[model samples]
Target: MTGFDSHLFEGRTVVVTGAGRGIGAAVAAAFLHCGASVIAHAGRDLSHAEGDLLSRVPSAARSRLVLLTEDLAAPDGGAQLADQVLARTGVIDVLVNNAGTMGGRIRAGEETAETYDHVLDLNIRSVVALTGCLLPALRASEQASIVNTVSISARAGGSAGSALYAGTKAFVSGWTKTLAKELAPDGIRVNAVSPGTIMTDFHRRYSTPEKLEATAAAIPLKRLGMADDCAPAYVFLAAGSLSGYVTGQVLEVNGGQLMP
Candidate 1:
């Protein structure tokens, strides 16, 4: 059904972090297409243009697409971003903590303290801080939802990237459940999307197609996930009727690779 007819998120405002590309970008586009005003965010590189993200959002939704840039790992970065979003949108109904970075090019002990700190800061701390920073705005809404991006590596311990990377995402999965309960009384819902072997830029730079395909074949679905394929789950989580009763949960979008 058209978003207007469904009223899934007719007048809602959503902020999607790391929205310049990949799954983040796709999720933002899906929300905008479905009638939610969206804030497209990015960190450092490509934060300004958000080329691919801008291209995907239909012109009709452009007015609702606000591009933002911030370093979420920094102490006040999350609060700063929230202020900017609030200044423009007035109220935030949904938050998708999709910003993250991998511990690229590392070996055991070769991973420096700086790199380890960076990974944890960007992947874990930011997710928590951003959510917390935006909580006040979210509380004002009648229906509020927060979706955090997780990974199979977080569950399996490690597949690609450094061990620290996996650990950070695992934290998100764990926090989502507890946070859901903590915020339930406040009328807010928290959930996560743990993606497995998706075809993203990072996956390509680290794991080759052959390796990814092999991994996908192992799954019952027999294919790695695409960014577009993962978008709907974000929509579902934000759609109160679709996920109103759902909170403190992790929806694994993996192709049955790590069935739990």
Candidate 2:
């Protein structure tokens, strides 16, 4: 997919949250590759991400990249980022709401108020707050899109320890459809990409090697997915040329792990 023409996204401005690593990083890279000026946001700092990107991205792409490090969990985080982006660029062509988390496996009986709050805050609340902040910019674009990163867990109710996290993603999945209908009249497409058992730092913490092997064996593909594997779905959704008539849909990138 490299060597794309300069006109692909010549003047487009894309905002990708939680782009410091994993799928977020891959999404940012994909957008940059297609000639879009990308505003990549990280949660705390960009020290590690900066190094990672500098090592991979070409010099020309660096000029088009803007790395933002803001704590998305803060009450005013979304507004602050939105204001900054609007100040620099009048419009945001694409908004990828990919910042999320899966709190460790804890049963409903073992959960506490704080646990639920933390999980829900990052998974769903932040997406709503951030999108609200950028609605104006998104509405300003003649071709706008909001691609959310959901999970296959949402449909399955998740594995034993991930029920709460799955519930939050389920809310996002439902909201994506509702918002798509509401925003369709304005030409702003809303959709989601659901990834399954990707091999990333995320899984390193939540799933053991044995567990991953078992998961891979169970999948029809007999392999785990990479961050790159999931990035193209976001690009396809963001690119009006490809997914112009597509909206309110969930594109799953799980190698047939979950049919629904």
Candidate 3:
């Protein structure tokens, strides 16, 4: 159940999406440490060896790492990503849809169809299609889990920076609950992780210096979040023995940033 609890992921096969950097990269490292073979999937940007994520990872577990690239936002990309993993691993025990976008915001009148669609395409549509495509492979495993990376934007309303991004994540907030119910009977667990304002590239891009400091200062914990802090939640959900009864839950990793 915990990455610290046990090597629960021993011999498992996992995929870490948007894994070239930031949170996704951190997640891949955690899983690799737990004895799982990792498929490091990324969009166009984070692709190869040099500054690529897999390279930064030390050689300790490098043999378990398989670095690959695919743009999940484009048509057929999700299926292609799954297909690539299937071709090599032949089966997958977990799928982590961690790839996303967070660079746009517009009020109702100012929003464009293309912009909205782009966000939805990568954040929501890709998740759905990839989940469908990977079902067969996931089912073949003795235990399977799916973790959708969501955001505080999924429900919080105060952010002027996440107008459209939040809307797309709201779909994630609702869909993961429903998907969990639908997939439970298949012996697979589906859940979402809604992280608060972390110091990821996404946050760095959207937050001004003043805004960043203010947001961190306002948190009850007096600090922003980190990728390492959030990655273990995914590990727990993916470990059946540890989180066999956990499903359809959104585990928030923010530091008292959004309270219900």
Expressed as tens digits, the lDDT of each residue in 106-201 for candidate 3 is 556676777776777888787888888888888888788999998887877638746778877888879889989998888989988888988877
Candidate 1, run of 10 with poorest lDDT? 1-10
- Candidate 1 yields a Cα-based lDDT of 0.81
Better of 1 and 2 by TM-score: 2
Error of 3 at 191 (Å): 0.8
Tell me the deviation in Å of residue 154 in model 3.
Answer: 0.9
Give each prediction's root-mean-square deviation over alpha carbons.
2.2, 1.6, 2.3
Ranking by lDDT: 2, 1, 3
User: What would you estimate as the lDDT of candidate 3?
Assistant: 0.81
- Report lDDT (CA) for all predictions: 0.81, 0.86, 0.81
Per-residue lDDT of model 2, residues 148-181, tens digit only: 9999998876878888899999999999999999
Candidate 3 residue pairs in backbone clash: 1-242
**Count of backbone clashes, every candidate in sequence:** 0, 0, 1
Best-to-worst TM-score order: 2, 3, 1
